[model samples]
Target chain A: MNAVLHLAAASRVHGEGATEVHALRGVTFRAHPGELVAVMGPSGSGKSTLLTLAGGLDAPTAGSVWIEGTDLATLDHAGRARMRRTSVGYVFQDFNLIPALTAAENVALPRELDGEKGKVARRLALTALEEVGIPDLADRFPDEMSGGQQQRVAIARAIVGERRLILADEPTGALDTDTGEEILRLLRARCDAGAAGVMVTHEARHAAWADRVVFLRDGVVVDETGADEPEALLVEESGR
Target chain B: MSIRQAMLAILEQGPMYGYQLRAEFEQRTGETWPLNIGQVYTTLTRLERDGMVEVVESAAEDGSDRTHVSYRATESGRSEVSEWFATPVPRTQPPRDELAIKLAIAVTLPGVDVATIIQRQRSATMTSLQDYTRLKRTGRAANPEAPEDLAWSLVLDSLVFDAEAEVRWLDHCEARLRRAAADRPAASAHATPTATPETSDGVAR
Candidate 1:
């Protein structure tokens, strides 16, 4: 399927015995190259759990999560960390910018951590910053930039090294409406440029920008609707 | 938006014919609410009848083979424009809320699920809210400093805020409904559990 991300029978169970909580259960999902999928569900429905698992930040209890045909479960700690640093990009609702670093340095940190030369990392960071339409702010620190600009810098960091998969969790929650849309447009543009994206958003309008939507309910995938058939998921979501 | 007040405000700028008024209004509002020339003419006629405006020069008097007639705002028209600017938009009775109406009807109608209606509308409203945000961004990018862009951005903000409020209201409704069902277990028991299988269990999650 040319899938960039594949989760088969994935489950996440926290604690054990009396304190056991199943965050996800048997949720099989896939996102192909060039596709942006939106994962939507109410709180505690396992949306974040699924995203964390897919990004290899958390391992599933029984199933497997694969990125570009490599199973995350099979990777050792260092291997998983290396894969995460090289292959996956994560964005959060809060801008999550490093406070002490300049925007360029913040974007460059990931590459530098991966053993790239300082000069090469900075150059790549500048390129990514420019791609996000904010190269002018490359030298500005996180505190010097507005919420939107900080987010752009964060995004620049995420896609700095041509990461194939991007995972965002309510990335626009901190911005105003217009600024939020601008961020979404940038994300959409990134996905259009051929990176597989899975954004967890409660807003359907943001979901509209996605190529498809996977709806979760109580740790299970209740419904999935294609871009051409958004209304289908709407109807199903409303319990019709 | 009150087209009448907007037309009056435009006339306050200078004397303009129907076509000119339409063009000016569209220019300021970025064609968000396109003005119909026929509507403009009709509004001008009413303004003149109400002594809010006067014909500056009728097309018949010009003898220039131009069918354009210009009108200027009278003292009363200028006052109306001033008042419109001074007064805050009235929201005592909000414009007809279709979602509210649907939920109201659903709650009373047998076999109708109010929660479903609210959720469906919340989803729709969220979609529109996002679309408005996108449009606002596009407008800003096209001309950030232009008056039309600012006006349209403000309009988009209004929609976004209202949609956000509607979603909150739907959530409130859902919570209230769940609470009510929890409080009156027997009352809800008699009501046919048709649409919501999860809720039918009477163990409110």
Candidate 2:
């Protein structure tokens, strides 16, 4: 199957010889349609770096990133930006919604910037808002809603216009327990609807919603668990 | 800890023979703790001796020349079930969890790659977590209001929570081990593995 997001042996380095920092090294990853992959790692484990590279926000110093069979390295800056707008969606920890815009407007902003007409963009935004289960809040501004509702608006923005790849960095970091879980449920539902998703999270409970988990350590892929591996008992039952 | 009490608890609501009792118990726990009919009968025999349950035999009502036997909780058994529910499960003594013990000893052994052990275990646990989550995804999404479905889901949720906690603890252990190594990369190399590694909470780095 073609991957919606793929990073092949991608590596990123910063600074000179004396103080070089390898944010990621030889990390290969993929997320196919109908799958959500969670990246789990401690601080400075290159999780955010991986997300940036996959989103084409940062270019890898080595290897390549492919989004929906298109090698990002082959695309120029304008091309990459267009790809980000058309195919990729990013949700950040802080629920990055423009304060001045209403919920529908915030969601419509991306599609509008992508050259979509106002009527088409607003319709798409309303559909996305409905998909995230908050259509009634479309007219409410970011400040008019709670954190969870604001995050829902942010997600509606990311998922508007049939975006194929969703990349979320700590998508639930700012919400409370129940609200965070509700957000994860929305992500899981999106993936189930055939959009590939890659989420970077420190919380294992949030990662449990993913179809697979990739664990990073020291800028390297230390371990990965495919959702299909079916032989082992839950660890608590291992001794029994 | 006795299957007898669980059987009694179920029987408290209605009567069941040995196999029926086993099935009922399995249904409630999603078969997480399966019991053989023999074990069920053994526990039943003991419960009968203690006067906690009484068996009723009915003559062949269908004229098939077969007798049916079922046990119902006695008054004493009802009291016992109530007491069991009233009391909290004890946690003074932790269960013998092999993974925790393995890490405990692995960290002490000289020349042992504790990080590898932790990493492998984490991977395995995550796989199990995935399996459980998949089961949850498929098994849910329909008939959620059914009692049996709710029972199964609750059991799966427990396993998911346990596995996630284990992963977090593994991450925490890795962090501790890294700090320990960085603190004494030189001295710890030649020192005896049995030597106690200082774990100061005050160490900032």
Candidate 3:
């Protein structure tokens, strides 16, 4: 399988001297097309740092990040930004929806930003919402929706652009287990549909949806055990 | 074999009690499938409860004057065993254990000392590897030509594989730990407040 996203010897540091904190240290991994790779790590293990760098949301202090053969570090700021806006989707833990926009409108924003007409954006957004099983709630604002519904909307917005890469950080953290599983099923379906994805999650149950699970510690890829049976990954984690 | 088939296979040769069946099974299989005595009795009792087996009156051949209750497969048990033999056993995927999960979670929690955890795991894994190596050596010396020698060798191979993999994993673990320790502040000296964003409910990716 060809890797759609690749990180090689990536490192990210915050501050300097006595206050220096290495968020990522020589981390490396690859996420392939039609695969959902779950990044598992404790709080400061640099899993998020890896994701942000992979998504082009944050630049690595050292090493290279490649998405679809384009090295993020080599691209200009505007080039990277455009790539993220058009080819990548992000699902933040907080949902990050515009407060004033309705669920459909929030999902439509990406398409609209890409120059689609308002009507066309709305139509595409509704289709995206339906994909997440939230078409009926399209007009509802973020505040009016439940946490799970909001996350569904977030997912809708993420895939609305038909981005090849989707980066999610604790995508189901706010929802209960059943709803989380539902969200995971949706993510799995996305992979089945040929979209490459990387999800950072603490919950093993949530990560079980992925084709592979990679363990990170202090910003480096420590272990990877999956790409086959997710249940084995769960058992390995539990045995630890 | 399915549990039913295993039970019937044990009884088909002769009527033996639960403990005897278990001992025979271990002996036959070369102890590859270890079953607790309690589990053996529990399965036997269940088989009896389900009418797949029936108790038979018996006495020890040695005439110890002790009553030994035996069980034989019933007609239904024979059918079940036959069906079991016809059916293919489903292959189970290897276990993805929780150790990786815990290690992943441990690295992300605030105030967690990743280096310390890796060091501790390294030492523990090394100790286990040494113990398994010693056990394998002892087994080889004690039963070089025993009938169960092949089985002992298989067990030794598995242990060696586990230990070798663990040692390699420890090397990776320690390298990452050293990098983390060298890069981060000492846990005790830096009292950074835990980043408890009300919205940050889980470990970030």
Q: Each prediction's TM-score against the native?
A: 0.76, 0.91, 0.57
lDDT of 3 by residue, A24-102 (tens): 8777788888998888777888988888898898898889999988898789988997888788899988889999999
TM-score of chain A of 1: 0.94
Q: Quick one: best lDDT, which candidate?
A: 2
Q: Order the numbered candidates by TM-score, best leading.
A: 2, 1, 3
Error of 2 at B86 (Å): 1.2
DockQ of each: 0.10, 0.32, 0.04
On lDDT, the stronger of 1 and 2 is 2
Compose the digit string of candidate 2's lDDT tens values, residues B1-205: 7566778888887777888788777655655676878889999999999999999986655989798888889999999999988988899999899999998888777887677777778888887777776666655422357675687678888888999999999989988877777778676663222122221112221
CA shift of A64, model 3, Å: 1.1
What are the Cα lDDT values of the candidates?
Answer: 0.79, 0.84, 0.73
What digit string (tens of lDDT, one per residue) describes model 2 on residues A1-240? 999998999989988676788888778899999999999999998999999999999999999999999999899999999999999999999998999999999999999998999999999999999999999999998889999999999889999999999999999999998799789889999999999999999988788788888888767787787777445333322232
lDDT of 3 by residue, B87-129 (tens): 8776685467555677678666766655555545644444444
Task: Please write out the lDDT profile of model 1 over residues B43-119, one tens digit for every residue.
Answer: 88999999999987656545877655699999999999999999999889788976778777777776676655655
Question: Would you list the clashing residue pairs of candidate 1?
Answer: none
Docking class of 2: acceptable
